[model samples]
Target chain A: MDDLWYSEYHTPHVRFSVKVSRQLHYEESKYQKISVFESPEFGRFLTLDGIMMLTERDEFIYHEVITHTAMAVNPEIKNILVIGAGDGGVVRELGKYQGIESIDVVEIDERVVEVCKEFLPQTSCGFEDERVHLHYQDGLKFVRHTDNLYDLIIVDSTDPFGPGEVLFTKEFYGNCYRALTEQGVLINQHESPFYEEDAKAMKSAHRRISHAFPMSFVYQAHIPTYPSGHWLFGFASKSLHPQRDLKADAWNALEIKTKYYNTELHQGAFGLPNYVKEMLKDE
Target chain B: MDDLWYSEYHTPHVRFSVKVSRQLHYEESKYQKISVFESPEFGRFLTLDGIMMLTERDEFIYHEVITHTAMAVNPEIKNILVIGAGDGGVVRELGKYQGIESIDVVEIDERVVEVCKEFLPQTSCGFEDERVHLHYQDGLKFVRHTDNLYDLIIVDSTDPFGPGEVLFTKEFYGNCYRALTEQGVLINQHESPFYEEDAKAMKSAHRRISHAFPMSFVYQAHIPTYPSGHWLFGFASKSLHPQRDLKADAWNALEIKTKYYNTELHQGAFGLPNYVKEMLKDE
Candidate 1:
């Protein structure tokens, strides 16, 4: 590899590139193309279908934020169902909680799990926990078939396009709503609010999620590796306001240390800027 | 002229690029290089010394958050001193408040202001206000000579390498502390914490500011064009907590139609992630 560089077009006119040391692994799975690259600054990163999924250096920010944010809101949450989190980063974060009884992960392609388990043990190590169950199937069908089982449903899917397009539909969100317990919480990887395609996806997901769950809300985190370095997440719950119902004291008592997620930041994350609020509210 | 793409290396290994339609203007100022570009997605943007300053698209987030965040903390802030904001964006935001009596902007390079005033009136129009007085001199000397004059001091300087390096030193911070009134607030463009070069600057600035002001704090905002898309700002005051002192109702009643800054976000912006908090505290 002579000065190998990987570039992703954030928009038609905007591009972000990384200087790669070399390609560690590349393979075509049943669902998408997965590749691992060794980079100097970002460390080793995994990409799916030419889109960035996780990098070893910054993956903790995304995984810890998504998992601990919900756990802090409802400390009693025992059962968690993660969809499309084949990298096992979300499951790895969930395993930190002693109270979580069942960690069910539904990944469409088993190859993603196998690749991660081999190359990315930092996250895939969660699979060793006795509570985790890897279900190799489609998440859309899994949620539609089940009812009132999970306390939390985490949709950690890829970008809302191609094979992952079905995950953003209103029908899929309705099924997630039905698949959750009374005090259920559904958190998804809402797309970026920048760029045309990402903004379109973000708006659509928020609209669909709002239709299924009346208590849908959005939060932001700065994941520098993402499209805009600014990313949003959808938090839909039955009757919990993330800020108002935050179990800060209770969560603090648990002493679950985190790099990104904190009680003060949990309240702050929900404080969307006026522009993003207008975008989400405009429907 | 043909397929022109402007790329800024965020780190040696990480690069961010935009497809440029054309170069609007290019010149060598007495201090550094100044250039402007027109891009499809980012609109028109300015760069000095091969580093991005601001773009028409997302400039509001930077200007608004920097200006309004401090204003909400102290609604009575009438005198402001801005350093190195040659683009006039800070002055434009400062002019929004009728109570602000004086805005003294110090830019070492006068050509940067002339270029922006000619080609970037969206921000440079701020020079129209009678209260704004531009002093084309060193900000370090200006602060050193003045004492107890400004109610707020905003250092919107470039990165801490070139001529702007003096602004991050303890002596300069001590000068800024002395150049403020009793209820003074000092804010500066602290660098990012991800990359090594940026993290070094951020830590240095925080360390220097803490030595001058007891109430030194750091806040974050998502400005995607900058390095790593995770930008930090320093807020040092005599006796004020950004979140606790935020006059949300007072600021809201003013009916300021802002695109990014909001009362809720003002409180939230100061809630740093644990890692960043640990980084700042580590020094």
Candidate 2:
């Protein structure tokens, strides 16, 4: 156990790893590789293709920010369409809201959902809620032709590669824009901005979202498990503003206890560094 | 060359590494082991006892925040004291200010200053400033018995272990408090609050500083090379509130161009997550 280390190369030049006490499960599904490991520091962590996804220790930060940021801004969001979050972290937070009417989850890999239910109960508990409807299919195709729509669309896919690669394309974003209500919000995993590759992906994603939506704002959060420990999320809407239209007063009245998300931090998260702002600006 | 990698264990169970082109320098100074490596992603990086200190790519984020956070709040700081930043990054930023009359840098290991000046000229350029004075001695001892007064004291020491363990002691904080002017400011490299061991150090340091200073506040930044990429800095003063007494208008008026440090982000940095606030709480 002393030498059992699970390593992932964040870049070709940079690697991050944790000491594994034991490997709980490992399998290759129809889409990609899935792994569940129990570690001393991060507790139980799930990885896809050897890339760290979520840990029992810090997944709250990612789950809360992704779900609550848009929910706070648009309290009128009656329906939520979650794309590619098979682990159920996003829905777990969404389930806390009594106002939301229904949640439609489109996950390409059903094995990820099944495995998470059996392993990561902390995040998978949301799957048990009756309000959540699960659909196993290609999210890209689902968005391309869907009669059923939502007021909020959350793109919680993996990196801009593999099966998740299609989710980042301008076509998928355009389809998502068409599938949403007139006044809808789009939130996606915008990747990290530190390494050259991740930064390229982040900027490209921002640009594509901008083309597909009337307004787009990129915000950041500290997720040490991710590459560079700095991760970005893109907020795009048809017409609503994240700040000027922020319903902080209403969100605060929910009294929903959160570890990371707050009205104050929601304001601060958009106050990104000048360098990051420069990178996001289109030349 | 294809397989060479420079690795550092952030915690007992976590390991981080960079693919190295070559080892630039490796030596055991009178104080500790000093090594430098060239990497494709991070550019050039310096390590002490296998701990990554700074990389050429992201050093600006650390150096800028460490100096500018205090500088923005108190622009009247003419005399300054820096402890243990032998890399000269702090002085490099401090040197940008035209009002800074004198800077006394007390680093225990002169070899670090020498090696940095020779190999890492990007950060070591400030050593050439005539207003800079280097005092090679134990910072704990120097602060305990210095008649020299400073308007601001920057504790840029390493982690609270080995040579740096003393700097985190209540005795050292008390000495720093005594060595400052009536309205002087104190800024220190407070450890991160993510990993168990680092969180323990960070909490203890905050407690010690709280005991010594009249006012103490903690702020965070994203530093990917560190243990968790979520790094923090301690800001303590006699009576100045970092937010209330914040001279944002004055700091903004300076028009000092920066890559990371900005007034809006400064105000936002103090908004900590609830989990972090709970960890920093005194029972």
lDDT of 1 at A154: 95
- What local lDDT does model 1 show for residue B282? 88
The CA lDDT of each predicted structure is: 0.90, 0.91
Docking class of 2: medium
Residues B1-283 of candidate 1 have per-residue lDDT tens digits of: 5799999999989999999999999999889999999998888999999999999989998999888989988989998999999999999989989999989999999999999988899999989999998999999999888754888999999998898988888899999988888889999999998889999889989998998998999999999899988899999999888888889999888788899889888878888998899999988
C-alpha TM-score for every candidate: 0.99, 0.97
Per-residue C-alpha lDDT of model 1 across residues A1-283, encoded as one tens digit per residue: 5799988888988888998999989999878899999899888899999998999999999998889888999999999899998888998889888999998899998999999998888888878889999899888998888754899999999998877888999889988888888889999999888777898899989998998987999999999999989999999998888888899999999999799999999888988878889899989
lDDT of 2: 0.91
Q: Give TM-scores of the second chain, every candidate.
A: 0.98, 0.98
Highest TM-score, which number?
1
Clashing pairs in 1: none
lDDT string for model 2 (A36-141, tens) is 9999989999999878889998999999999999999998799989999999999999998999999999999999999999999999998988889999999999
